[model samples]
Target: MAELEAQAPTPERGLAVRGLRLAFGDTVVQHDVSFYVAPASIFVIMGVSGCGKSTLLRHIIDLQRSAVGDISFDGQRLVNAEPARRAALQRRIGVLFQSTALWSSMTVGENVALPMQLHTHMRAGEIRDQVAFKLALVGLAGQEQRMPSELSGGMAKRAGLARAIALDPDYLFLDEPSAGLDPITSQRLDALIMRMRDALGLSVIAVSHELPSIFTIADDSIYLDNQSKTAIAHGNPRHLVEHAEDARVRAFLKREPIDEPARATTNEY
Candidate 1:
């Protein structure tokens, strides 16, 4: 397993979330969530099913507003910034959704090129070159002409990742990046993620429940509890498995039986 090397120190080049609260109308999902993602580090949001892991990702990306707290990227305010400023801030971040969210109608090349085209004035030829370069970085070279429907599940995920880094963004956010893949495929994806972090100096924030992937790639992690609707543990996943004070957190990390009765399973946001 390849380990992520430490990056050169750069002050203020990271993400900060302070007292974040998530809600949908009268239903408050989580409250008082706070975490920091250091520059070029891989930070993971983890928990059991229905713990609002995905919902927290949406808030950080500004797709959904938080009920309380502030989010900052490299010292720039993300939440409640002026629209133009917020948009500018967002352009520096990239996201790969759980579904990949590639356009079924477009070829993989087109998908990768879209962000550059929309955000920059690069000529068509330059975009083409960049698209190829990004695809190659994800081990998807020569796959430009293939449509999303033509890609297998793993290919589609890589394609989506290619698109995510298209603009050379500083931060990368992934939602359930290893979901539904076999163990080998998942391990490959985990390796790819570490490579991206090392090669690009990206601060990565991922929402996931896959224990293997979590242990393999995460430099830091926070476990959100569904019942408490807040983070119960925060640290390296491996450390937490053995040392977490919360029994629920330890049980989840170690895949042991929880003492309490199971709650009705609900879809995680």
Candidate 2:
């Protein structure tokens, strides 16, 4: 495990976006947004259904093309980086989708090992051990051969998380951690996310509409209001609730936070 920890990339601090833009024909998704994601920060990007937060995230990861602006990771421009350098940069980051996105046909161990197998030439036994260690790290020890179909929804998300953390990524981008989770499961997941963030020293980019999740783990956030066509607010969610000057931000914060499976509390604790 020491080698794995050492294998982790040099922790990159901060992500910069300037004049970022994205549009589809006549429909614009993002409108010249600019912000900074501080290092090791669980920076939540929140918004209503059509505000383009996710689209902006995709551009950060280079998964989608931006119409204009600059996105740099630790000073390396994601939009303009050379191919090989970009590939190296990407290996240091990991992503978790709204869906668990596990391969239904593979076992837990197989799923976790896929990225390593594709990226390295490690022999079979070593890969197996690595898989076991990663699963254990995520509290899923000894469930290596279980099929994805057999997992509960929460377990599936945990498994996906295990895979995401397997490489000990320096930066993690999660689309939605509590999208479909029950309150208890979401709480458990939140604890795990914080634990892993500390344990692995990762910078997290979390996207969600769930204010509870944002408040519990986020150090800061960027809120995009679809009607405003810009990030209506940015800062600590707790502070934003009481201090934001924008009407849209006040309305957004005042709305009761809700999630399926009914969480125990709505405050971001």
For all candidates, the clash counts are 0, 1
Q: Pick the candidate with the highest lDDT.
A: 1
Model 1, 109-184: lDDT tens per residue? 9999999999999999999999999999999999999999998889999999999999899999999999989999
Best by TM-score, which number?
1
Candidate 2 backbone collisions, by pair:
216-268
TM-score of 1: 0.94
Candidate 1: worst-modelled 10 consecutive residues by lDDT: 1-10
Tell me the spans in candidate 2 whose CA falls farther than 4 Å from its real position: 1-12, 256-269
TM-score (all chains, Cα) for each model: 0.94, 0.88
Candidate 1: count of backbone clashes, pairs at least 3 residues apart or interchain: 0
